[model samples]
Target: MKKDIDIPEVKNVHVAVVQEKHLEYKTIDWNAYIINNSDTDLETVLIVSQGKSETKITPPMRHTIAKLPARSYAKIEFLQEKVLELNNTFKVTFFEGNKMFDKTYVFRKNTINEKALQTLPLMQLRGVLVK
Candidate 1:
């Protein structure tokens, strides 16, 4: 017989975009992170970018996390050429204890103050997942 499963709340996870500087070329790089803060372990975690204009900025990048232990984070590095502007949204999906959960995070060009770009390893955006 089939059984009902509980759907995990989006709040259990966290996501962030980080900006890093290249030491050799002195250029900027962007990366995404999925942090699992809940008590359950996440399986088949997938991070995908959405929106037309957004894909142009970064060519439809996707990252997968086979398993994300609770209280840990998985990083997805953006290795493409730097673009002057970025306005995009990312969706993160994963399963916890037979329950599925997903959330999207939107980012505008000004999400991170332009001035802050001067600093290395800066967190461009950060927030808890929400439905």
Candidate 2:
């Protein structure tokens, strides 16, 4: 039965889009990161992302991490300005001990911009946090 299965609730993990300057290229780039705020490490971490709109849907992008240490973060990918106009989604799953957890974070169209920048958790960077 579905109720017999244990699907743990996801917490202390987040997906964020950060705006960073490319000193070498004299340009800027928007990067996605996965943050782990829990005290335990996450193993076999997997993140699938995509951009979608009523008229168009970008191909799903898959990113994986063998293990994510506690209280740290990892960069997923870079986003172009054009992609910023589409609804971006990040589906994250990982295992802590013997339990599995998953969560989806979505950044609505036109919401990933400088005006929405804020200090991110466990990192000294300013970016938009998926709500």
Pick by lDDT: which candidate is best?
2
Q: Which ten residues in a row have the lowest lDDT in candidate 1?
A: 119-128
Q: Write the per-residue lDDT of candidate 1 for residues 1-131, one digit (tens) a residue.
A: 23555455587576655566768889876555666767778999998874335356456778888999877777765534243256656788888877788778765554543454332222234332222
What's each prediction's TM-score?
0.66, 0.96
Off by over 4 Å in 2: none
* lDDT for each residue of candidate 2 in 23-96, tens digit (9 for 90 to 100): 99989999999999999999999999999999989999999999999999999999999999999999999999
Error of 2 at 38 (Å): 0.9
Q: How far is each candidate from the true structure, as Cα RMSD in Å?
A: 5.5, 0.9
Q: Considering only N, C-alpha and C atoms within 3 Å, which residue pairs clash in candidate 1?
A: none
Candidate 2 similarity to native, TM-score: 0.96
Candidate 1, TM-score vs. the true structure? Answer: 0.66
